[model samples]
Target: MLPLAPSFDTVGWLTRDLATLDRVVRVMLPEGSRAASGAAIPEVLLSVLDPAVVQAFRSAVALLVERGGFDKPDDVELPDVKATYAAFRTVQAAEAWRVHGPWLTEHPGSVSGAVADRFRVAAAVTPDEERRARNVLAEARGALRALLAERTLLLPSAASPAPQASAGGAEVDRVRGATLTLTCLAAVAGAPSLSAPLARVGGAPLGVALVSAPGSDRSLLELAGALVDETAVP
Candidate 1:
């Protein structure tokens, strides 16, 4: 409802099962999306994730190969995830400031300290920084599209396990930065991404993500459903 950063905001629904999720997606998204030719687990992101996350992802991939009979895709180089996160944050802050700056100014002392602090940072984003970020985003979009034209790009949903609610700001920021590095790719590229909760780390659900080309929402959903179903069978 609120436009914190409208560009990356999506209309999504929650469903308990793959069939229900498929139904919801079909009802919401238009038909005629193309299917991905295959899936690839890109290793570029491993550098930014915690060792636990990396191990979980690799274990999940192994299961996909041994149980699901899925082929292991060759390791391929990808655009820098950290750089993409930086560019995404810059653009997001600039846009957030554009949308909420006037309101905040008119209603001083309305928002909390953390919110105020974030808005201050958003407010300080320079025009040149925004321009450069946009350029980087454009390049990232193209690169992602090319890489995912027929193949689905697979990776971990987050860089690490969930942090404690009472964790300090610095620790939270560190984890958030690493997470944004992976998530920013799909957002910047405007592509479809599906996170299948088929992996775990020390009992915590560690989602393995599947990213496909733009306009491939239905296809991506189908792929996710198939994978989930296959893994669920006895």
Candidate 2:
């Protein structure tokens, strides 16, 4: 889950991540279209959400942010988070279609051909749309950072697990696990660490961990469990 506080710097961290995402979109989008200036095309793409792809992306982002501590028990206005997540997926799907659309149409019988055909249609109809999605994704990233800036200090929740005693330090051990996960998330997002110590538990560095897992994989679940466990530990 994304951390909401304790790592207020996550806003800056997200900004850097978005910049990297922009680079990725540039590389994936049509050669010339990527270089074209203005956010017009990208905006249009964001407006049209691909049900499956955008939903998947939103789910993944929500899970990731929630793990990092950005989630609030009370509803938080996170338009940027939702928008960015959707745009990222849309751009990725569009780019995939652009690259493989022709191949799919050529070999309709094959799975690749089928996928390619779908992409081909998507690209053909929404050439500018793909670029627009990328731009929206960038903007969403920026918005998330701004949102995070206002928050500070993340508290543990009932969902978290019990902390374990370790020689290094109880808090340190708990934080170590969270830190490891957060660092991995940062690497994936192309963002820096927005993690900080929240408290001291049995001489351990118990802090709110802000990891970023993109999908609901076993590894991510395990890490989340660890985070919650540490928090719940007495």
Tell me, by lDDT, which candidate is best. Answer: 1
True-vs-predicted CA distance for residue 131, candidate 1, Å: 1.1
In model 1, the Cα lDDT at residue 102 comes to 95
**lDDT of each model, Cα atoms only?**
0.79, 0.37
Q: Which ten residues in a row have the lowest lDDT in candidate 2?
A: 33-42
lDDT of 2 by residue, 1-234 (tens): 433112122333222233353455345433321110100111222234324323333343344355663343222343343455445545655655555556656776666443444455456646677677667755655643443333321222111233455435546544444333223223224332223233333344433433222221223223333334234332
Candidate 1's residue-wise lDDT over 84-158, tens digit each?
Answer: 788899999999989999999999988876678888999999999999988988887898888888678888988
lDDT value, candidate 1, whole model: 0.79
Off by over 4 Å in 1: 67-69, 230-234
Per-candidate Cα RMSD to the true structure, in Å, reads 2.2, 17.8
